[model samples]
Target: MIDQYSFLRPWLFCLDPEKAHNLTLSNLDRAERWGLLQRFITKPIADPHTLCGIQFPNPVGLAAGLDKDGKHIDSLAALGFGFLEIGTVTPRAQPGNPKPRMFRLPEAEGIINRMGFNNDGVDACVARVRKSKFWQSGGVLGLNIGKNASTPIEQASQDYVFAMAAVYEIASYITVNISSPNTQHLRSLQSEEMLRSLLHDLSEERKKLSDRYGVHKPLFLKIAPDLDQEDIHLIAELLVEFGIDAVIATNTTISRETVKGMEYGEEAGGLSGAPVRAASSQVIKTLKARLGNALPIIGVGGILSGADAREKVMAGASLIQLYSGLIYRGPELVNECANALRR
Candidate 1:
């Protein structure tokens, strides 16, 4: 069956990456509705790991960016991911960057994207998750929320708070995304002062929501891969100081070192794939070393195989996520990686 689908790759690859993505997602939605996806795909491995007080069946998770609006939770969960993170959703829905924004670096096993936090807004995303049969089946879902692109840096906290309030009731865990490079000055929020203030405000709001909803979901920080030692240390300190639950080390990186000579190498956006493996792992190692197990780390970036997943675990990641890898490898990649983790 996998071999038969291999023939479709050329046709699928012919389309622009963004269009192909939408078509694929739409097909999966239809498959679920027809009750065919579940019968064909292998069942997800149930390794049963715990993180942020939630029990995940396996350590391997589908990273954010693939399902921006939680629209295909059932389809994704059916593909054997241990957990699924949906969105870099903002307070309001907005069209992302212009066309040709998502580019594939097949030669480098990488992808360059300036997706710019595109999604159908927090309320819509929350509503879909609320209606998801997958969620009703007790699947673990993490909401990755970010500020709108036009929102000022100083006022970014308000956007985060708004998203949090909207999705707080439905999310098993919430990830605060402040590292995407496509948005102007978004990464600046990672600086010491900005990070401190942003996290402090969000932390206060998280507590309020927790009490109000009578549920204490873990609030994590999703960081970027393009940070220096000082930047990493400061962010680690902030995570500890602010009582943030976990840190998702290393979102897509702006550095094009991995895809330096590729066709889209010069594109202005974050690069994600095999090239980011070492950089992201280093961040995880640094964070774990700094936090000393005080906080759990969710490692993501450049994970293409089980070996990559194992390396992340050895480096101190309690959980692992993949985006580009899935695009290049297909659904079997998830089962293969999870099976490798068990060994």
Candidate 2:
């Protein structure tokens, strides 16, 4: 496949990171409308697989954050991802941090963004998802839910409950995203005390929703890569205790040791991309050792090429997702990673 991004990336890089992000999505949205996207896409190899009761056409998926409000789903889904995960949508709409919140660390091939779960409210996102052709197009859809920025930490569970119920019917699975560094005290939800309470509430609600809808949609927790062995072990134990469906091995990391001297290296958000690969894979390896097939693991972080993708699987990820890789390497990375897994 020709690398159209080779021509586009330089121009995109010249724009401010957030502006570039919006432009890429808007352009793809337009492309989908005109039915011109297929001309740019080279379909990935078939590697259909099942995880958490959902069938993914391949192991590679578009991670949440890229299409925060579910807009551009048809365009992104058409780019040959096995599935598409959208949003970290909260119960209510709220603008995120001020400008320059997102930054690029090209030297380390990482990005730091404190774009604190900036998304349309859950209701609005639900409307967008309902309108998107992808929901009805047989592609796997995972809706990621988060707490609103203004909501107090103690009241976080209410936001999660509201978002989960709002999208439960349409979601193939729901992602409990409590690890994004951008949200104040959000990672605290991962602590032993908060995590137990949070999962308990979500699990109980899921049971009722399961009975009501006659479908048990799986729920996965997107965790942080920065965790000690003790933390990982306890989190693994909690997964079994709560009967959680699957685990997305990592969100982004707050640690900056990897890119300390690079531009934007000290930015105040989770750092992602190549710098996150090792930490993310290590988490997967640790979880796999502890869980031992209790549930599937969807690995993500720093997957910029087929080799990087394979590293996550080799570390025991049953599946993988991408965000930064799609930015630097473009859609062809999807096929590259899918083919790597096929081999």
Candidate 3:
């Protein structure tokens, strides 16, 4: 069935990209509250897949950065994602970079965003989750955490730990977002020494949180797709050594090779969508070869269709996520991917 978003896309595209994003989500929330989504949206086929000790209704999920505030969980969940991972939320609220920080490369079906982890803070997100129908009903929720821009890079671990403690009770799993290129000095955390140090701190903290809550929540590390072979291998080794429960093969790429001459192609932010798909798949492929079953890979990068979703799976992603794809495609893409992946 054709999705309602296809019809709305042209009109939405006319507005500023960031405004269009906020408007679409805001309307979705209102539509959901009015009980109109179920009547129009197709439900995703149930293709249960378990990862990190949690059973998801389907393998398709909404990637982080889409709903950074956790304000639209129920509305978005109504769109048929098997799970929803919200935020690159930080310990404290931040207004993000500035206006026009998000740009659309329509020709390449991609987005360049330097929103800089804008969020209403972790405490606010946890409060929002508590009231959401999805979270209340036990829908799988992954909370992505990051450091505040004001926090020095060396003390980034403190910000992460603070946010982790806040959301630990509500999140089905926690994603350490150390790879967003928009943040200054953030990707440096992906380097060997910094990554090892950060993971060590988080690993030890997880033990304490698990003991305190009497529940073990998996930790997922979201990495950049810009790394070379050596970087990928070392990350794989560190993930296992640190006992991280899973890895999100990619976040977004700083590379503009695919969208070079297109409008806003030269924008300085992570380029996500069709442009980053291949690189993301390669990362998943390498990680799967090295980590095997020892670590589950949650593949996410440029999935815009069911075929794209399958490619990630073929590369060994146990599950897949969508963001820019959702912008270019529509809500129906969720069902398309879920149906394709259904065994």
- Per-candidate total of colliding backbone pairs: 1, 0, 0
lDDT of 1 at 57: 92
How many times do residue backbones clash in model 3?
Answer: 0
Residue-wise C-alpha lDDT for candidate 1, range 139-175, written one tens digit per residue: 8999999999888988999999999889898998999
Off by over 4 Å in 1: none
The window of 10 residues in a row where model 2 has the poorest summed lDDT is: 1-10
Question: Where's the lowest-lDDT run of ten residues in candidate 1?
Answer: 1-10
lDDT of each: 0.88, 0.91, 0.93
TM-score of candidate 3 to 2 decimals: 0.99
lDDT of 2: 0.91
Selected candidate, larger TM-score, 1 vs 2: 2
Candidate 2 lDDT over 89-131, as tens digits, reads: 9999989888889998888888899998888788998898888
In model 1, the Cα lDDT at residue 65 comes to 89
